[model samples]
Target: MTTLHNAEAGDRDRKAFDDPAARGQLIRWFVSAAAISVPQAAGPVTFSLLALVLTGDTSGGAALILAMTVAQVLGAIPITRLGRNRSATWFLQGLIAIRTIALLLMAVLAAYGAPFLWLFLLTAVAGSVHGAAWGYLRSVLNGLTPASKMPRALGISATLNEVTFVLAPVAASGLGSLSPIFAVVAMAVLGAIPALLVPHVSVAPIEDTPHAGGSVLSPSILLWLMCSAAGGSAIAAIEIGAVALAIGFGYPPALAILFTVPLCLASVAGGIWVSVRNRAATRGMVVGLLCVMTGGAWLAAMQHSLALTIVGAVLIGAVLAPLATYYSLILDILAPPNKRPEVFALLRTANAIGIIFASAVLTATSLSVALLVVASTMLVVTLIVGAVSFKEKRRA
Candidate 1:
């Protein structure tokens, strides 16, 4: 039965993509989504360089990112709800515009030898709109494509995003070496592409939907959100700590890509696999993926050898897309139709929170300790999700 449903869904997706108009809109959204992801993905490198220029230490960059992420978490739902009556394209554009302005101003102020505090505030301003922008961006897809096409659409988007994740940091590093301010300006300009490229999608006010009053964050929903955060933390621990991991492995900081590049390539492969498979994962599959990720985290944490660490990174990366797709698809099913923007906003926010958590741990602790903490967290989350799945099945 499941195979038949997936086959039908694949057929529908193919027919929809066969339409040039649908294909163009989806292609544009893919580009826009990739653009929107750049600032955040390039942030650690960009902000780290900027901080080094302003202050002698690089710690300020982490502080700025934390401020931005926290503000995003606080503003996500409220900012998304504000757009309930507006077109997703319009609202998303405005949000991107606001962030672009904030980033540009931060760059300008930094060039003038402005106070670091001023730069921090501007970073927060830019970040404040990020979660909502992502929410509306995700929401806009629903209008352009059918549910049957989502797995492919999301898989392709994930692949693009991983590519961005892989390349953005390199771009930021190269640009920042020339000038950190230039990198910031580049980030702002690239991020604004979404505002121009996103297709106009009309959205009905939340009040009009039949499921307008349904809860957005029930237990089932929280379970997936928790998994999303756990995955984010594990990934962040590796990416953000890549330099340190390299140093521990007796390599120069520039060799950090040895760890990061493999992870990203594996992630791209995972995304492609999801696209080709073109189906939602079953409960058992999800649980299996969760366990794979947990094992990956533990492997990286063990740090017995370089080969093992790289293997761990690969394991985690290989499962990232499938699990993330599951979270997004499940959340779409569980959330109120009218409140999807808010739920999706929370989804991005949860991932950001996980990144922040990893950042915080890295700040006060050694890389070894932080990896241990990340490993433990993923293990606990996997266990909890497995337990929940078991209970739900028994009830069914």
Candidate 2:
């Protein structure tokens, strides 16, 4: 590989700029990674509904998601343990194989018109295994974009998630209704295709250097991890609620798939707007998050206003696409390198927790009420962060 720059100005941030060729290379790789995630973000809808279809209305869709999350939380450390020594490629390839097999089984089960829950459980397992690919690919991307442009890169990347819903669900459910097996097979194929494009970079193997920092059980780390889990749970809550919103508003239950497709696309659109506008500073992001959560919650709370709900969904989604990525980058800027993955892992864990919390809230109250709480919490968090950021800025 060609050395782009070595000066502190260049190296302080770890990405390339000024080279169209490098940018092109980055685009292809990033797009390839993002492409695979399409199945990930969209797969749950199909899996959930598939469960409903194959098993009964009492499908394990929610349970499957919870199970997958449980697996994800448990899997993170071990994957990192293994990842720290192994090539990221090994994980990537393994996920593809695992998903391919699981999906194939799901297709077969559907073909046979097997028990709904059984096939869904199969799909859930496949989806869960594939989650590792996100962190691994993101690590690789950490080396791809310039420090200054990192936010934009991440923004665009998050935004592309919008594409996940575009065709997958419509195709899956629309066609899957007619032929479930074919839908499973197509998804399996799409999910596996990207592994081929990852370049063979000779990074130090996992065994070459031991993982940095403490064990996954370390105390300070655990606290941070819990917080991240909180956020993740919130995300899940919002996601489930969003689907509910789509259905409750008089659309066909199947329309959740259609609604999600555009939501994902819109997230990407929001990301692109941020990327081009260059407006994702710490304060801006916190503010944006607050705006989305609060606005969306208020809209949902109103319940009777379709216009308000749509506006809220759009506003809430606008911030989610790039929110996590930017937050991670900011943390990276603030923390030492050895602590990065642990931090990222913890944040992801927190997000899971947030989803759980959100789910609980939804169960206790209307989606609108739960959203009101979510929005308020988000707004408060953002305002506090913004205040701190301003203080820190002034101090500096």
- Candidate 1 Cα deviation (angstroms), residue 287: 0.2
Candidate 1 clashes between residue pairs 3 or more apart in a chain or in different chains: none
Off by over 4 Å in 1: 1-15, 203-213
lDDT of 1 by residue, 1-396 (tens): 979977886687578768898789888999999999888888888999999999988989888888888889989988999998887788899999999999999999999999999999998989999999999999888877777667878898899999999899889999999999999999999999999999886553222113434677777777888888889999999998999999998999999989899999999999999999888899989999999999999999999999999999999999999998889887777777778888899999999889888988998899999999999999999999889889989999
For each candidate, give its TM-score against the true structure.
Answer: 0.93, 0.77
- Backbone clashes, candidate 1: 0
Off by over 4 Å in 2: 1-21, 109-124, 202-239, 242-266, 278-280, 288-292, 334-342, 345-349, 387-395
Q: Name the best candidate (by TM-score).
A: 1
Candidate 2's C-alpha lDDT? Answer: 0.60
lDDT for each candidate structure: 0.89, 0.60
Model 2: worst 10 consecutive residues (lDDT sum): 201-210
Q: Roughly what TM-score does model 1 have, to 2 decimal places?
A: 0.93
Count clashes in each candidate, considering only residues at least 3 apart in sequence or on different chains.
Answer: 0, 33
